[model samples]
Target: MNAPDRFELFLLQDGEKKITEKIFTGLSNTSDFILLKEDHTLGNLIAEHLKQAPHVLLAAYKIAHPNVPEVMIRVQTDGTITPRDALRQTCQTLVQMYFALGREFQKEFALRQFADQGDQGGAGNAGGQGGPY
Candidate 1:
């Protein structure tokens, strides 16, 4: 259902598939708790990374049903940031880290290539002359 004040909670079901959506107005937070889903890897990954965010007091997922692959996540912040914001920040940080790691790897690869060329006696001038130009 939709709330006038921006906060709302509702359930969406399609045959055997169901999802509970929770929305918080003040913090502008929203999350979906999935039930009977075959894969909970994305929820678990988000929980793992959201825990490292600043002001995040708790970020975890749980399996509520033993018979089904039901998973729910509760992300809490210290009033400084919304749970959605925290998760967004965490994802941004991960992207930044991934780029930084890629840059580092490129640098290492370039250095290794230079070393290999040196070992192959290609350190001198490109021409056949061994001149110090």
Candidate 2:
């Protein structure tokens, strides 16, 4: 058992119940993390980060059922780091990335689409239906 992450606190927590982590048997350097009330987005994000990590050998997740908000992530790392640690690291990295992204967004929004510079993001639409959704 572990405390819920800030993102998880809202989307994945069941009152005081936090995310549950379990180490699977017969699998070297592999562990399973159960994220209650979670979904594919968070699971995929974490798995992508773990896959990008140098120490991670394999990372994947599954939801037993679509209606169920439980995500089980399996992380396997090289001997360099434990599966739990890899997951933790991925979460920390994601938090940092989100913070940086927020800051950058604020800075960009403060510029108001660079209106003063006459770069109105083209055709005065800025970001409309013509752009990628």
Best lDDT among the predictions, by candidate number? 2
Clashes (candidate 2): 0
- Write candidate 1's Cα lDDT for 6-123 as tens digits: 2212233346554454553434343444544533665677688887777887777787665445677677778788766776787788778778777777776677677767789556
The per-residue C-alpha lDDT of model 2 at residue 18 equals 46
Q: Which ten residues in a row have the lowest lDDT in candidate 1?
A: 4-13
Predict model 2's lDDT versus the native.
0.77
Give a tens-digit lDDT track for model 2, residues 11-65: 7344644467798876888898898877889989898788998899999999899
C-alpha root-mean-square deviation, candidate 2: 7.2
Residue ranges of candidate 2 with Cα displaced over 4 Å: 1-16, 113-133
Q: How many backbone clashes does candidate 1 have?
A: 0
TM-score of 1: 0.52
